[model samples]
Target: MINTIVIDTEDMDVKPSAVILSIGGFAFDVTNTSETQTAILQVARDPELALYSAQAFYGLVDTFEQLMMGRSVSSETQQWWRAQGEEAHEALVGERQNLATQLLHLSGWISQHREARIFFRGTDFDGSILEHAYRMCGVECPWRYNGKRDVRTYIDAMTRGIRGYVKDHQPCFAMTKHCALHDAMNDAEQMTLAHQINSEMLAA
Candidate 1:
């Protein structure tokens, strides 16, 4: 329907704002680097687009409880945790500090780009996780309430409520399914293409 109708008004400005982010979930695994992609340096180099993945660290008690809760995890992973002993606790503490540093860096970026819009594929999931991470780190989320944007909602608006169409059409690339960086990049690319198409429609 978006393709069929051309609304005559001010041209829709689809040039994506400054940055796109995909925060990883609450779960933390020291062995899994896929969930943590700290892009502070990248953000410094390119102000046009920024992507980051935030990870949370839980205490050993919580970790074991989580292990017990996650029955589907492989035996090897369980054994790995068991073998960690005091080293695992130390690692988690280090990770928590790293998370705090990352969040502070993010806050600085957001402060610098005061008007930038933060886009997320699933805001409720990613956004909440990021916010919680901030709280856990004792840092305030820097972006404003209205600055939080959702990719699905944007796509639906741009495509006349077309559902699941964009998911299948990821631009020429292989996404490492659960990898935070890959997922964020994929979503950002989809939003960019959708914005381009929507802009063309408005011009037409």
Candidate 2:
């Protein structure tokens, strides 16, 4: 069971900050804050599970990037990008299976070890970029074009009944007017902003 669901976005955009993926007793928190700044958080009975999640998540991003770029990924290419992608997919599975596996493990761990629920919060770009990348990579999300499982529900929950905020917040940062929307921020900085916004929300 998912105990916590935290969505992060800029005050000006509706992009998702993070998507929390939990497994038997672990959580792999995936975030797309920047081109190179991706994150995976693992929480399980065994600490080693975190390593597996990290490797798998990184492999997924790498494979997805290659597919999105449309580089000649065939084995005939001197770079063998296609073969490398195939190898990356194998590595991702060898490291971790589908999203469900990670969630189930986290649920089990919470039940047996009394671990706290996992939550993710970040900028709106997180969701938008992720959805775009997923689509580009041919991965199907059980959500709408905006990447929210339910658009109306997502708006109400994220905006807290602030109609104007809900109305203006876009699914991707690129669509927003904020100058920082597309400005590259390192992973640590992005994480800091995410935490800052989450804290502000809690304080309110």
Candidate 3:
């Protein structure tokens, strides 16, 4: 049984060191050697409520080529890639390096604080996507693996796994689904609600 660790996030003068991340990508297919395409990655830093994010998209040219060969991708996705044209891949040259550097830097900073945590909605999905990206870049994930936290797990535990409970009470910071940046920001907001719920339950 997992226990929920709640804190008084609202009244605290000094915020804890943490970050929330979200990734928008193709369906997670472990069997696929290509490891699915990661469309975007977003990060929301806590304490200062700062957003230190880097956005990157890869394989647009390859996707476009595939579509030319009559790939059966969704019309929306195919149109989006077609709109980017063949030069889409070259336009974002070195973006992967930039993304990896930013991730490495954030991981390094978080690792400096023993209690710092990295929060994501799903550890298996989001965390694995991040790990795969880092591996592709030949960069080691600097933060301790134990520091990785699951927002969904914490929130579910706080709400006793009641569906829609968190959604009803949580702040409406997320406006768009399937968007990494928006989802990451929303997760940070949801964490505050989780803390409040846990605190109230404890008080009662």
The model with the greatest TM-score is: 1
lDDT at residue 40 of model 1 (Cα atoms): 23
Q: TM-score of each candidate?
A: 0.51, 0.28, 0.49
| lDDT digits (tens) for residues 1-204 of candidate 2 | 222222222211133222221111122222222321222222212334343442221211223333335422333433432334443323234343333343333233334323223222232344454444355445553235532332223334544553312333323222111111121112222333344444568888
After superposing candidate 3 on the true structure, give the runs of residues whose Cα lies further than 4 Å from its correct spot.
1-99, 108-114, 164-167, 170-174
Q: How many residue pairs clash in each candidate?
A: 0, 21, 0
lDDT of 2 at 179: 12
Candidate 1 wrongly placed segments (more than 4 Å): 1-97, 164-168
Residue 14 of candidate 1: its Cα lDDT? 16
Candidate with better TM-score, 1 vs 2: 1
What is candidate 3's lDDT per residue for 47-91, written digit by digit as tens?
A: 111233222111111223323433233445445544553433233
Pairs in steric clash, model 1: none
Clashing pairs in 3: none
Candidate no. 2 TM-score = 0.28
- Candidate 2 yields a Cα-based lDDT of 0.30
lDDT string for model 1 (61-152, tens) is 12232223331234554465455556322323322224456556556544443434566665554565556556654688775566566767
